[model samples]
Target chain A: MIDVIHPSLLLFLGAAIVPLLRGRAQQAWMLLLPAAIIAVVFSLPHGSSGAMNLFGMDLLILRIDALSMVFTSVFAIITFVGALYALHVKDTTQHVAALTYAGSALGVVLAGDLITLYVFWELMVFTSVWLIWCRRNPVSMAAGFRYLIVHALGGVILLAGIILHVMDTGSVAFTAIDPDSAGFYLILIGFMINAAVPPLHAWLTDAYPESTITGAIFLASLTTKTAVYTLIRGFPGTELLVVLGVIMALYGVVYAVLANDIRRLLAYHIISQVGYMVAGVGMGTIMALNGSASHAFTHILYKAVLFMGAGAVIHMTGKAKLTELGGIYRYMPITFLLYMVGGLSISAFPLFSGFVSKTMVVEAAALDGRAWVWLLLSLASAGTFLHTGLKLPWFTFFGQDSGLRPKEAPLNMLLAMGIAAFLCIFIGVFPGWLYAIMPAPVEYNAYSTGHVLWELQLLLFTGLGFFFLLKHVGGEAKISVDTDWLYRWLLPKFALGVQRVVDRVWDAVLGGLMRRLTWLVSSLTHHHGPQGILARTWPTGSMVLWVAVMLAASLLLYYL
Target chain B: MDLGRLLEYLVENARVLRWFAYVVMAGLVVADILIPSAYDRFPWESIGGFGAFYGFISCVLIIVISKALGYLLLYRGEDYYDD
Candidate 1:
């Protein structure tokens, strides 16, 4: 049965074959694979179905519960959208990497055991880094290297935790475990790194913007959200996540505000949006968990739409920095309108997808009686509107006319974006379509009078503040130093200084050894020369006389 | 209606739109007070126009504080890493 085959295996197998098919065959396969996977994903019934015994343990390979289903559905959808967007891209490596990356994420979401999850989790790191590296630029190559190092560290941490967790608990089921154990916390740290929690987060901001245009769409959608899914499955209600999540929510926004590059701005915003999901998971209530899951769902859509828009601009203009791009709407009005849909949706404006999903998390915080979290999250929302909603579009599409008159985005790009833009609005207007598929039953209404008024006043006044400080909010032609600066700049310089000192000491040690060898050679030469006792006629005869004398003495002794 | 022309017209008449926004803001503040809230877990909820003030203040602070920190500690030239 199609249902018997794992959707991820389908994708991996499809990726393996992508290079074989060429031209239109490859394109058809690229588009059809995700659609077929979607069919396979939906055909399977929700529960732990694909179970098999491997060695001593039972590996539950496919668990199609509501939570996994939510993420898996989106993974398939985004892969399709991403493939469509990259239809014009001739790079076979990127297509394969992206498909496999999506497949690995689906594998992560569906894995019913921790080991299964860990396997897919590590696969995600290797496959997704190629999406960045395939850009073939030095900057991307370097960024991809950093990205691999960070995620590999994360993978090691997760594996250590999984080993300890399985040994200690005697179970590998992917369920919420007690956070008191060292193993769980190690796992959490690993998850947090992939989730792009601050300090550990700079890799995301560093590598994502450096990805190929279509690659960023894939990069943006999968890794962190998959981590969020795993968190929901494994660590729902961990209290520390509340604080880290809030800090991440705000930290991302601050960096985003300082970002000059258009894609980097969006990348930082990914951290910010994911922060909301993390906070929801931290709240740990049914409503909050559902909120986090649903928010992940919606965030994937709107964020993808947002990336698609930014990508369209970059694709057209060959410029990614905001300082270098302006008044592009004149040339690409369709792209402009589509991008604004994403912008407004992300800001949680009423009737947008973000409004429905993001508010639920805040509402969950309020319902859980976390007043401070509620306030901070509210502030983050306003900030979200300030930068992504109002600032990004205003500066990029409509701000100072930098007079870049690139042609409109290619039709394939627009078609993919158009699909994403449509979904963003579709879910916005009819959120029940999304809510029905949530991990938990939906009880919250987004359009209550108070909620509407509050969000409206919040977003509207945020708009007011934007216009009030229009000049101040514009992007500068400067790059923002994130936590990656510690490794990217500070660590390398520190290493170089250490190397210089090491080199000097090494040279001195070698010189000292050489001096000693020279002295020993000179002493030996002096002692063995004609002027020395050893250099007497007997010795000067090249030790032959001495050998003859020793032989004679031995023979005399033998005769005696 | 031609959407581009409409958008252009909107952009050109920015001053009037700014005034209109201010008027809307004032009206919303009054409505915020008059319209009873459904959830009042926080004290700020009871305060009329709290959302407006909080939103405006937070947005301003996000921009101001972020820019201050950015200028002070975060930003470098585009070639900062390239070297």
Candidate 2:
């Protein structure tokens, strides 16, 4: 016995006890599990553990390395923050689903074998979808189903890939996969789907905005970040990811400009932000990988803050669309301030957490002499600020007054947001704490005079442009047709059309058969009736005459 | 001080804040000329105020292009998928 306990196990077992307790005890339990998991994750030794042989395959349930540690730490922290944010909720089901979802994500980060990873990967999907359905609305129900179907398909593809890879290599270890391996593209596609790579991404924007307010916080923090971790772990330096990542970075920003729902806009930004991590993994340089890991850690905190702020507004006002929100900053100033911290951090302002981490990836691109990648990424950064930093806040908080005066968010929500806000600033100011835990030693400086000046010029000028185009950038009361339009509209319509054709063919064929069968039945009935010729009384006399004739004919033939 | 009231004050002084923004922008452009980067991998980085010009142009183009794309193909009524 190695005397090690998986952080996921702590959360899983802790969740089992949630229903048995009530009131403050339950809340304390909810908070305590994540706190304890954080401690356990920090204390984990840097090696594989919980090894077992199952069905002739070696399974490592826990793998602790610098890479895994970064993800597990952030996952644990967000679980706690999310718990605090949801403390006031009376529903036990959401609580259980959330804890297990977080744990499953941790299990994914810590998994050391393909089997273990796949098991946790599917568990993540099943557990997280409940967060959407728990909203208890028709839209959420439909969105949850779509979300489930897409992820289930992705999971099947992943399993196929894992099976093929294991068969080809005769190993199940979850390590760097060969690009030429049979399972390579399948597994990458699976991870990319979860990472919200385009054409497979609409499930996120469609479902996440419809999730329960508290649920969106965890939903935002966990699923895609876990996928990023897997990408970093399994498929580093794949050139395809580089192209896909740049597309994702710009793609999300483009959609964000068209989004009306506040959470939906943030959801689009998630795709954009994850693109950075994906690109960093593609770069495969030490600095780039570290940037991906660190960016994920910071992103979880700040993104949670943003969601929390948006959720608070929704919780209080019962409105989620940006067009319907504004001027409540006067009532919920703390929420506004905290949200701006997140917005600024995401925009990579100097002395913010995003500044330190996001720049590393861009710097890596610069160092790699990929001028186009660097420029495109820089352009995306400006767009990030334009939407998340400027447009979102201006519309939601400070734009035309909607005259709705909702109370400040609940105390627990404020405390959760406050903690995340503090961390965003704390990490921004002293990135040394964050950098120390990177998989590679840090050599980048984020606050150099040149860098700060350049970023300021970029961001401030973007703000200038936003002000210039303020009237046009305001949220419109319309939805953007993303790739989900295929499944939601086109696919369903096509299926209906196919069903109509099948119905018409069946009706024509069955109708003809029914008519023929009716005619045959009538003719048989006419012949078999009691009044027919074969049943007449004279039949016996005719039968005798025919028999005599036949006897005579037979006698003649025999004589001949 | 109540943060809300402070924000209200800032909003009331929007003109002054706008000037402040302009001042900061001007200052950053000036600083771009004086403080050269330790490492300039790209030739454009050597140009003074390139960051400002690019940032402004990028922001404007992002807005215009995205909105145009939205109106032309992406944007639909809220009940797009309902039927």
Provide i-RMS per model in Å: 1.2, 0.8
lDDT of 1 by residue, A1-560 (tens): 23478999999999999999999999999999988987888787876777877877878988888889999998889999999999999999999999999999999999999889999999999999999998899999999999999999999999999889988888888889777655998999999999999989999999999999999999999999999998999899988899989998999889888988889999989999999999999989999998899889888988988999999999888999888888867678888889888899999988899999999999999888999999999999998988888888888888889889888789998899899889988998999999999988999899888888899899999898888899898889888888899998999999999999999999999999999999998888888866666885654675888889999999999999
Per residue, candidate 2 scores C-alpha lDDT tens digits across A1-560 of 44699888888898899989899999999888888988888889998889999999989999999999999999988999999999999889999999999999999999999999999999999999999999999999999999999999999999999999999999999999999899999999999999999978988999999999999999999999999999998999998888888889999999999999999999999999999999999988998899999999999999999999999999999998889998888998999999999999999998888999999899989988889889888999999999999998899888989989998899999999999989999999999999999988999988887788889999999999999999999999999999999999999999999999999999999999999998887777667657655555666888899999999999999999
lDDT of 1 by residue, B1-83 (tens): 26666777777898999888889888888998998877779888878899999999999999999999988988898889887
Q: In angstroms, give how far residue A48 of model 2 lies from its true place.
A: 1.9
For model 1 the local lDDT of residue B27 reads 86
lDDT of all predictions, in order shown?
0.90, 0.92
Clash pairs (backbone) in predicted model 2 = none
Cα displacement (Å) at residue A326, model 1? 0.9
Candidate 1 — what's its lDDT?
A: 0.90
Give me the displacement of residue A477 in model 1, in angstroms: 2.2
What C-alpha lDDT, on a 0 to 100 scale, does residue A556 get in candidate 1? 100
Ten contiguous residues with the weakest lDDT in model 1 chain A: A530-539
